[model samples]
Target: MFMKWKFFDKIPVEGGVSYQDLAASVGAQGEIVSRMGQMLVSTGTLLQPKPGSVAHSRLSLRYKTGNSNGSAFAMLYDDFQPVFAKLPGFFGKYGPNLPVGKTNIPITFASGADGKLTPWEVFAQQGTEHIEQFGLAMQAMTGYLWPHTGAYDFTWVGKYAATNPNRTLIIDVGGSFGHSLRANLVKYPNIPPGRCAVEDREEMIPSITKAHANDPVMENVQKVAADFHKEQPVKGALIYFIRRCLHDYDDNDCVNILKILADSLPEDEPQARVLINEHIMTDPPDREVAAIDIIMMTWASLERTVQQLEKLADRAGLVVIKVHRAGGSSLGVLECKKASRS
Candidate 1:
């Protein structure tokens, strides 16, 4: 709390402690602390306070508190308390790769050319990584912090699925395990089971499949093992759901991924819609969500502006037909169709 409070309170202006002073305060000890410090330096959480000092690097962030719901301190506490609570059990049994051991690399969302991790990707990757490292308890922390419950993402995606009464084939690209599809199925209860297909890395298949052994809905969902960089196997898919996937990669990679999908579709297939579900960064950054911008930086991803999306769509031979904001949600639904020329 002391370090976090100081970190949130101080500023590196004309007068500040040297790097040496900062290091001393933290009590530099074993390899773990060193490694943790290195991560902080790399993630821009800690920096050189003065010329040749060896203390903890001086750190500062411009933040204000006092909101009705909670202050910044409250938010940080609320966000991290759960993680800290489960740390012993999750880390003790699972190992140290989870978010517990002060090894977290803060993400900085890059919208510009500087190139960094987008907020959504940071949250998604970290959330998924947490679950992978620490098991179910860590998953709870992720579920709590990110895409927080009652935010309307799953509900709306289910509604979208419901609209396609034609037994439309839904391909969930890069869908982690079958979590999203399963959630959507619960929302659209009437939707048939056979219409859902999830594509992910080969390694994730067996584990995810085993985890869903008891789920009756899992029978209908096909798990396809393929790389997103290659051509999409299912042609003329009714809807290609790329939720929170693109932002994990840079522009060139996204274009390549989209090209593969575009090439797989029949040019005349009107049912083919590329649905990109992501948190579109507002032009003027929203301060409330600003922490995410910094989070993206550590991971080499970005939250793009609307213009960026359009340009990327044009390059991929897709036309942005409509942009629908998910009701009471942070993510946007970009409905795209193949371009006439492509």
Candidate 2:
């Protein structure tokens, strides 16, 4: 409400916009606006400069319309409100355990489509608007929730790519619009774009094609419209990079996805890697990780720890080579290789 009316930018540090002026500017009832403003004030997001006036608190100032990332918070709230409200009922009807099936999760349960559609299908029904917001929200997330800075020293892939330019260096499974791959290319220019690929659903190919035109580095990236659950068509790739994907499915499904990548590794190259980039849910996890675990439950998934990740890789016939993570960071890159090939 405040953002739409530019209250954060309009209100000065010493003074504030009166309730009458703010309400009139936005064609809303003054009393209703005042009530809504009060809710924000209680949260330290807004300031009640006077009995009938409101101003931007230090926190609120950061939410100005110019800050595109703030839209992520709004999008999540708007899209997940119904699902969040139905969590208790979903557990009651489907049992208290974490949802087990893709088609019967909290999202599907909330929409009364339980056992009928996956969360993605439910979102598809809503058309592209929600998905567009979701994309932006994800972009915003990359800024903080999953900072790519020093995440895994992706620069090494550049040298790895130069070793055999014709051999595929990376296949980013389930990478949406190739944004992650594009960022990596920018960071590590030596990583030949033609040697890397990004696989996603067929419907997303047009967008990926459009996105590729936006950045020259992405021009040579091979965009493959393939499902990760099925056979991996690109064989013998040096690196199969799957980020924030395994945590989206159950253990059985995660194992299958890993196995597909494991199978794609060349027998001669024991050093071939499968990089899993995800958050490690700790014992008595920090508030952030714990909160994310519950949120992911809405989609019938949970974050995994290092030990849990190792077990998943082992089940997929792969061995965890090492965990690359900076101190005080729960997000890590679990580097793995095919056990049989090793």
Candidate 3:
């Protein structure tokens, strides 16, 4: 909290400052700042090259302003902290099994709307700053950990887009700031511009546009505002790419979202695909994946296994075609198609 709200962020990254000086700069008590500084240093974040003097360690440098990791820190401080505080009571009341329907852990505890609103809605009510910070945090988390192009093969999609000039290539559902789409386009230049589009909430359009304003890849990437829970507006796109979206909700809501995508597929185009990019839990669960699974519980969601994804796909009237695992990473690109009725 001190780092996010005060001392750590205020101190110069290159130079060392005494804890007392740092605290004075932020109007915080010297003793409190000293304790926090020592904690950070002990944890391999900040460094004290000289006694009583603190500076940014290599790791701490990542959390400076304008850095994605910095945004992540802000997100942790502003968003998750409150929700996590309520976890004990929530788990005690609800038990291990999460509630069905739209009521989620974050909604149950963090929402002021009497468990009526989703986390996104709560963020919306909090205004733009909250939304922007969340977006940045997501960017930092994904960009730093997973290389989107390396994670999934977009060659086939690019080839299809190159050949089918009239058809849309990729529709990034809930794509914030077009980061995933932009990354794919950068990797696959053969995929023509204007053939790709991104759909997000209406409030996100301006920020998305501004985010991609100067990027040549996004010059042709269309940005549309639409709710995912409602019927999908765009139809017959070669691929509907959803990354880190479904895990935000429970199984029922996941089914609803996938069903809408499935329903939008062109009847004649059996080849159209829905690509889901998420962390897939393994048998000997990766420690990080396991940790995320528990953390997602705070939002009434979980990191699903392959079988779990398949079952969820089945419920949505879709068939899981492939699970493309990112090499040496827990992230998987699960490919699905509309289930055939014989």
Worst 10 residues of 2 by lDDT: 62-71
lDDT of all the models against the reference? Answer: 0.56, 0.80, 0.79
State in Å the error of residue 140, model 2. Answer: 2.9
**What is residue 243's positional error in candidate 1, in angstroms?**
0.9
Residue 118, model 3: lDDT of: 65
User: lDDT-based ranking, best first?
Assistant: 2, 3, 1
lDDT of 2 by residue, 14-115 (tens): 668888888887788899988888898889888887798888777776566534465577666766778899988998888888788898888788889999
Point to the candidate with the largest lDDT: 2
| Stretches of model 1 off by over 4 angstroms after superposition | 1-168, 287-289
Best by TM-score: 3
lDDT of 1: 0.56
TM agreement with the true structure for every prediction: 0.55, 0.82, 0.86
**How accurate locally is residue 34 in candidate 3, as Cα lDDT from 0 to 100?**
84
Tens-digit lDDT track of model 3 for 1-342 = 654565657768678888778777768888887887788889988888888878877887667655667888788777777777876666677676664445545544665453577666678888886787778777775653655667778878777765667877789999888788888888888888688898999998998888778888897789999889998889888888999898887899899999999888777776788888888888899887887676687776888988998998899998988888767677889899989832
Error of 3 at 247 (Å): 1.2
* Candidate 2: regions farther than 4 A off: 1-68
